[model samples]
Target: MTPIESQWIERLKQLPPKRVAEVLDFVAFLAAREERAAAPQRLSDGLARLVALALPAITEDEVEDEIQAARRERRASQQEA
Candidate 1:
């Protein structure tokens, strides 16, 4: 393997069984942490792609107006009920 990998193996070999297990656990935790960090970005990217496809020409101002209108309509209906 590479020199860094060889060095790591040698260092791990110097440790006791319990310490080796701890190191392995820590490595797994780091990998899991990395995966968790990337998951949100992946979700956001997918959402952006869906929005682009569904509303290619929609503007932020238009979205805000639509939201305000919907809120007003809902409130009016609630008052009637």
Candidate 2:
């Protein structure tokens, strides 16, 4: 392990079990906070890549048509069953 990790381990070993548990909970909270902070950046990066692809946007009518087609397929499958 790294020196910092070793130091952390030594400090943790000196603490009571309850204190160690609290430290663990705090570390988890910090990690989750970091992930939450990164999520929006990740979403923005994904959207940028999608925009870079220059794909045509579907119209609302097209979306409705897809939904209707899916419903028709489901009905057909249910009838077959």
Candidate 3:
């Protein structure tokens, strides 16, 4: 596990049972929602809609720009290595 993630685990272990249950339930609920995208999502569904819509309208230029950025990152990593 990553250091940051291990730190979170240690912190959660200290919580009271009731609070731990509440946190676990909330995390499970979020993970389930993330697992089920591509089914119909509704706007009134709060965070579900927000996550579904966070990817804004994509244009050809925007896609090209992301491709260029990825290539640059890869090249930089290779050079550093």
| Candidate number with greatest lDDT | 2
Candidate 1 wrongly placed segments (more than 4 Å): 55-81
Mark the 10 consecutive residues where model 3 has the least summed lDDT.
Answer: 37-46
Per-residue error (Å), model 1, residue 77: 44
Best by TM-score: 2
RMSD of 2: 3.2
Per-residue lDDT over 14-73 for candidate 2, one digit per residue giving the tens place of the 0 to 100 score: 999999999999999999999999999999999999999999999999999999999999
Q: Candidate 2: where is the Cα deviation over 4 Å?
A: 68-81
lDDT of 3 by residue, 1-81 (tens): 999999989989999889989998999999888767633454346667678877777899999999999999999999999
- What's the lDDT of the predicted structure labeled candidate 2? 1.00
Kindly give the number of clashing pairs for every candidate. Answer: 0, 0, 0
lDDT, residue 39, candidate 2: 100
Q: For model 3, which pairs clash?
A: none
Candidate 3 has what TM-score? 0.42
After TM-score superposition, the amount by which residue 19's alpha carbon in candidate 2 deviates from its true location, in angstroms, is 0.6
Model 2 TM-score, 2 decimals: 0.74
